[model samples]
Target: MEPLIKIEHMYKIYNPGDDEVRALDDVSMEIQRGELTAIIGHSGSGKSTLMNMLGCLDIPTSGKYFLNGKDVFSMTDNQLSDIRNQEIGFIFQGFNLIANLDALGNVELPLIYRGIDKKTRQELSREALRMVGLEPRIHHKPSEMSGGQQQRVAVARAIAAKPPIILADEPTGNLDSHSTEEILQILKGLHEAGRTVIIITHDPDIASQTDRVVQIKDGKIEKDYWNEKE
Candidate 1:
């Protein structure tokens, strides 16, 4: 099967006066469909830069990125925006939910942008909440739920669109051990259900749980290995 994401000699450079910083240096990678992959690196190791490129939020200065077989860098800004919304779901370290929006509303926010009808959006949002085992908290606001519940709601929001890929950046960074385990299980379930899941994390324990782990350092890949037992 064709890879869901293909990167070839990717380079992202940030310029400040005469100084240039290489956030990603000739990074090449391929992510297959339905596979759970983790990008592990310390701070300033270029993992976040790679995530930005993968999520289509930032374009590389050179090299090529093919997302689902399309030349991502070749797309116009408007087209890239549309693809970001329709093709990829993102879960952040901070649960970026609207304070006023309840669980269902938060999950339906993206569908609203897609111009999905209210009835259908609500139905699908409820289903998403159910998928994350958040049906009982659909009416609750973010402030009213525990960190784990809020993160689960965020997961529901990410999956609500049924996007082919889910990009999670430090998803468990703020949760306790129990919550981290809960979140990991939810992510594992998503992968098992055939969704492409890519995570960026520094935590070895978290990285160990994925189907494959890619270690990066100094803006380049250091190792890429599959956990045979997982």
Candidate 2:
């Protein structure tokens, strides 16, 4: 079977001259379906650029990205948007919840964008919240919740649509240790439940939890290896 994501000889260069910045330099890798992987790097180590490329939020300057065997660069803008909506769910470190919207409402936003019916979206949203242990806080706005609760709501929102891949960029960056563990457990559960979960972070502790770690530095992949967990 083909890998779910494949990139070959990829490069993302900015300015393209004497002062050009190569955010990604000849990077190449493949991610099989249902793998729990981590791409770790420091702040300027090109991990974010790679994340944007993986998420289909940005295109590389050169090279190929095949998502599910489809050439990503060949996609039109609308096609890219549709694929992003249907194939990957994103969880950001900031939670990114709307201050005015309650947990349920926030969780339903993506479904709404996907044109799901009100009744169905509400059902999915509630179920997602329940999965993240936020059933009781369904109607609470972001302002009324703790940071962990808000992040749980964000997780609910990301999973509400059942996207096959969960791309989390520093999902636990803003949380306390307790909250970080909570989020990590949730992500682990998601991985065990058959989703492809990819986490991008600078924290080795976070990377250790994943099955595979791909470390990036200076726009290159420094190491890629599987963790030996007993």
The best candidate in terms of TM-score: 2
Local error of candidate 1 at 184, Å? 0.6
**Candidate 1's error at 194, in angstroms?**
0.7
lDDT of 1 by residue, 32-69 (tens): 99999999999999999999999999988899999889
Candidate 2 wrong stretches, greater than 4 Å? none
Indicate the TM-score of model 1.
0.97
Give stretches of model 1 more than 4 Å off: 16-18
Model 2 agreement with the true structure over 90-185: per-residue lDDT tens digits: 999999998889999999999999999999999999999999999998999999999999999999999999999999999999999999999999
lDDT of 2 at 112: 93
Counted clashes in each candidate structure: 0, 0
Candidate 2 C-alpha error for residue 166, in Å? 0.1
Q: How close is candidate 2 to the true structure, as a TM-score?
A: 0.99
